[model samples]
Target: MSVRIAVIADDFTGGLFVASNLEKLGIPVFYVCDTAVLHEAADGEVLVIATRLRFMPPARAVAALDGLTTMLDEIGVEHIFYKYCSTFDSTDEGNIGPCGDLLIGKYGQRRLVFGPGYPDLHTYVHEGYMFYKDRLISESIKRSDPITPMNDPDMARVLQRQTAETVGLLPHRVLHRGVEFARGYVDDQQGKGVRYFLMDCVDNDDVATGATIFRHDHITTGADALAIELISQWTSEDAGTRRRTPSPVARAEGGEVVLVGSCSGVTLRQRDHFAQDNPMLDIDICEADEDILMARALAWADEKLGAGQPIGFSVAGDVASVADAQAKFGIMGAARKAEAILAGIAKGLGGRGVRKFVVSGGETSGAIVEALGIQSMQVLPFDELGAGSCISRDARRISLFLKPGKIGAEDVFSAALEKMRAP
Candidate 1:
């Protein structure tokens, strides 16, 4: 199969989310951690490269994409899609707009389309304002996020703060006119020198319609839902050749454990809701001493594992304590320490015969997968929260469910566990 789309995801979980969606549509996909492995797996119909540039500075994110375009060009991949979190997670000094700018510069395109709203996940953008399940992002729990606190709900305004070019809106009204009209409208916008567009999508159809208008060379942006739409269009040309076929479900044999390091309200609810029936361990970053915290957590986990109980680990504390830790150690410092602890616990538990894993937060999941020596994973279907199983590509072959943290429901953890254990 020829490579139809080359995706550059901002983080690991985001890459898996896109890859899972593509796989569901029967579009063969190969996901790589970095550019070095691109040569090892070049035969898949779609290539999703997971880059760690999302949390970096704009200059760094742009710099990271420097040699990437040349590689993509040589590979004969014409269409490039830049995927970020559906929640639009980034600071005013964005890795989104800056990274988008770099792609535009490399492709020499006068216009680019960008939107993070995934209606299936209750993320929507209308009239240039972002809404998380109808609540404006500024009024949502994301406002309290320690990393990229979404203070302004206006996406164009938010993106304008990051890019030098003017950000325009491609409202739902344009999409309602149909894909051809939308394509014409986009062309008109490009003629006006509008380089960046914040498109509105209320549902999958809206995204599909918007995606239908995209030329093979036009750069598009959004979450996995957008990619689903894009892939659907590309595959429809040969419907008989690329239809979904059922396969036997793979059931993992082991108890499950969940580790959460993301402080998003969505993850907080998932962790707390799943905690109702599961054993819980909370890591207090304010404990100040890493050795003592690690020792205590390992002891507690060993005890739970010995009894064969499903356990949970969370790195969240009370508001005041978290603030104090951030104030003392700085945000990056605190995050690194928390990830280290979680990675250590993951390695320890995996060594003790634990195979089933549910990891929340991108950084936390990345650290655990790396520590567990998981180079790649086979995506498995789960519930609508976009949670899916990833069997480790290595000989160890552990099962994992990597949640996007900002997506999923309060019962997402339990749902994922149920999926993992399903016969």
Candidate 2:
């Protein structure tokens, strides 16, 4: 079937999560990082274009999305979902707000609904503020994020700062009154020139309510929860049953490598938990030269891979160490250098016949995929490896488990290794 839904994910991991959620509902999804392979996605029910636009400047990110709408239009996409992080990760001069504006203009919609709620992940919008579990986002772990630290809980205020258009809130009170009242509220707000509505999605029911309210909207932007709800609503009974039988897991040969570039608390804990048994190399980006780092990491991997043991290399550190590195080499510079080193190590490992990769961090995953020259990867059925597991559609036959920094369990790394090796 031609693609009915198109999800423009701001980052790789978020896109993979959305695709995985759809797969759980038995909807076949084709996920591509490079738009050149859009033709390959015609058979899937949903087309998710994963972009590395999350960290780019607003102007550059907008420019990157310029022709994507046209491409989706040609493919018979009925709905467009702009997927972002559930934490609402963005700066005041956002890649989110500016990109949303661009999408609004492209879809010719006066108002678009924006909700960053994924209750399963303890991220949801209530009233106008975002909460991480029980605490507001300002007081949550996201406050210490190495990139785009969230210091505000009020999402409406946050979004308003990023866009020139008038931003408004769709309070939970209105939503609790049901869809009919909610739709009328949205229509009235849009009539008053509210270009974007920050929705209050505190639970699954709230997400379903938001889905019903914006069911006919040409474009809706939010985290994976909202997309999941919308996709579930759009899926017909027959289509949902078409792929209930899981595809046999693709077998992969050669060595395995785990690369962690995220400094999130969850990732750090996962790294520690995995290190208790498995071999891991901590990448020291602060003092080591890039060439020397690559040489050392490759040599280390060679020994581990030769011994038939899966190994991990990490640039993950505590907040103090991350701050120190950022101070030494500005934030973006430090991040770029670390990503470059990890990407180099991945390339070197791939050359040495390492085919299964368990990668952590969104930017890190993007870099490794780009370095490996992988254009498109099909999202595999939801497995124990959790959200972002996929097999490359290219000749390499590589299997990858791409985990977002904050979304996995303490044993996620070990779980990923086991899942990738399953027959």
Candidate 3:
């Protein structure tokens, strides 16, 4: 039998996207976003699964994980890569005892590689934003964060490490890369195709994936010139196949366009009640399941005619915890939630006259693209992760997206309810 690789996680998009990347590298992929078959492993080389969605009480989550261990043993799953989760806001391991730091101690670290579960940040210079209009072309780069390939420490608090390390990793392609990538982003009527959100790292253990920016004076930019440059790169044959629908015929509408972002519905508290609406749903930061709620949210949107409204929305997901900054924002779970909501909404929006949607969140955008089930995508030179996009037929039903709770939690929601008439 072929060595089967199964990706289990709390969020669907992140797990699936990672699996897809690995698959392109010639790995067979299987996913268990559901808990029912977590232990049901196929014989494989390496298995990557996240623990946050296992959101039962610690004791309960462990029991369930214990059952998974037995299943893994029965299935002969040897190499396992489990995302060692920290406290929601703290980098310390709060509940690893029940989940077996022992087994993982014996096997996980060696078998698993830990880092940011989403896209690495590639900065885009949004022209004409006077706030950033100041000339920093003579900027001196500094070591802002800890070193990379370092020990697995909590990232939320690691400002120095996160910032300094990823500075150069961003695509310098702009200076020496593609021009077409920059064009078609926007027109005068439309806004810039994308924006740049930058930060200097405070602390992130090196060895974590790249693109973890720590701090910042300002974030994000929008400009029309960037769009023209982006669209110039859009050849009819190229973008047509990749588009979520036929590409919008008219000029671009930059930041004004609403995009989908995804995070767990419960984890992403939309209002001041914050953590109250579904306090019952809080799981160990490592143990929440997104499939169930994601399924329901899409269903609710459809039942509610959420697809019909001429609205701009983001389908955000996987808000693991508000406790910590690193885990809270740009984590894999967050990305997964973003992808799932988009998928659910996409399915719901099929043929419903829903046209275009834009994306802001990085990880969520990655999840959306991955969920589209395409082999190779038509991508531009910017931070493809954050590059503004309208996914086509795969998003035929509805467009969904997600972002961290900390970013634009209010302004980004896209759904509107239809008023009811009573006799």
Candidate 4:
């Protein structure tokens, strides 16, 4: 019944994604944002620590993991999973490779497994190159990402530029041979001093095979799919002893607000779709000052606050519009300005009794949550509500539906509101 698995996610939505995957296997998961509460997790529960380090400098990101290994050791955690986006969203100087190197050095492990694929989302890796459906990631919608535009689809080369260690790849052809051959290939690569290993997961079957080969490894890093497969394998080994009581249904009592800050193609489409029925206001980040924008947004929300239908405020726009904003106010400057304006509006809505929040985008979610002073929350099984929905356990009784920028359906906003209000 001791804690066996710990996952360090680089962003809020990624952490919730991993927790939701583990919940699929009925493994109890404690999702926390604050590192100080690591010891508070109950016995037998997996710990998923969500951090806002996705956009931080490599050194700062590595420094944030300073005492995490020691904390996990004290809590009897046997394995560590480093989770990032499926598209391998990182810059040339990364929070992925640098963070992975820190964990490797702390755990004294020779090779760190990297699988940045989630086949369900049409995001998978093959021959060390990442793809979205049939198109290479470099040519996909992710290339337009403002904060971390993925111009290179080669994950091995992408990760190599971030760390000083040698990187290797395990292709799908070798994995198609089976787990035994795949394991031998990985072993051979490690013998040649490859400190990092990226697995080619073109489908769910490849993910399952890779999970089987590394089920008992000291460390396994990837998106949610590999972790889900690994947990399924581990729990099946001793099903009777590993199961824990299911969490109660997560519900909250408050007004609802949908905040959109992602500029991804999917989110832009979702914003347009939701605008057909609900009331939505787009925050202009082009030329307005932060204070003026926040004031204008809050004033607009004052009229739409208690309209029964969920009111939405978005910074999402077409790729051309985003590019225009980036040209006006540098890339990061525009993003930070949008996040600050949204965070301010969230605070204003909270004061007006809006508690059920459906947030779109990773960086936007982090900004809003931190502004609300939320340190931790209990992870709930929200597959029914949507992909990544959960409720806060604090006094506010807030409900959060955190949708990754490029994730969720066109009707995701209305669907989450309907589910949140369902009796």
On lDDT, who's better, 1 or 4?
4
Q: Any idea what lDDT model 2 has?
A: 0.86
Which one wins on lDDT? 2
Model 4 lDDT-worst window of ten: 238-247
In model 1, the worst 10-residue window by lDDT is 238-247
Q: Tell me the TM-score of model 1.
A: 0.91
lDDT string for model 1 (314-402, tens) is 99665676688789888778877888888888888887778889898887787887788766566654336574567765566688888
lDDT of each: 0.77, 0.86, 0.30, 0.83
Minimal lDDT window, size 10, model 3? 214-223
Decoy 2 TM-score against native:
0.96
For candidate 4, the per-residue lDDT at 251 reads 76
Models ranked on lDDT: 2, 4, 1, 3
Against the hidden reference, what TM-scores do the models get?
0.91, 0.96, 0.35, 0.94
Clashes of each: 0, 0, 88, 0
lDDT of 3 at 389: 21
After superposing candidate 3 on the true structure, give the runs of residues whose Cα lies further than 4 Å from its correct spot. Answer: 1-14, 35-56, 84-93, 96-383, 386-423
lDDT of 2 by residue, 1-423 (tens): 467788999888889999887887777788898998988875546788988889998889888887787888887888889889998998686688988889888778878889897998888889889989889999988888888889988999999988888999998899988999988998898889897999998888888999988878889999988998988777663363245544666667878888999999889999989889889999889978898999999988877777777889999888889989999999888898999999999999999999999999999999999888899887876655669888898888899999889878899888887877878
Query: Model 2, 405: alpha-carbon shift in Å?
Result: 0.9
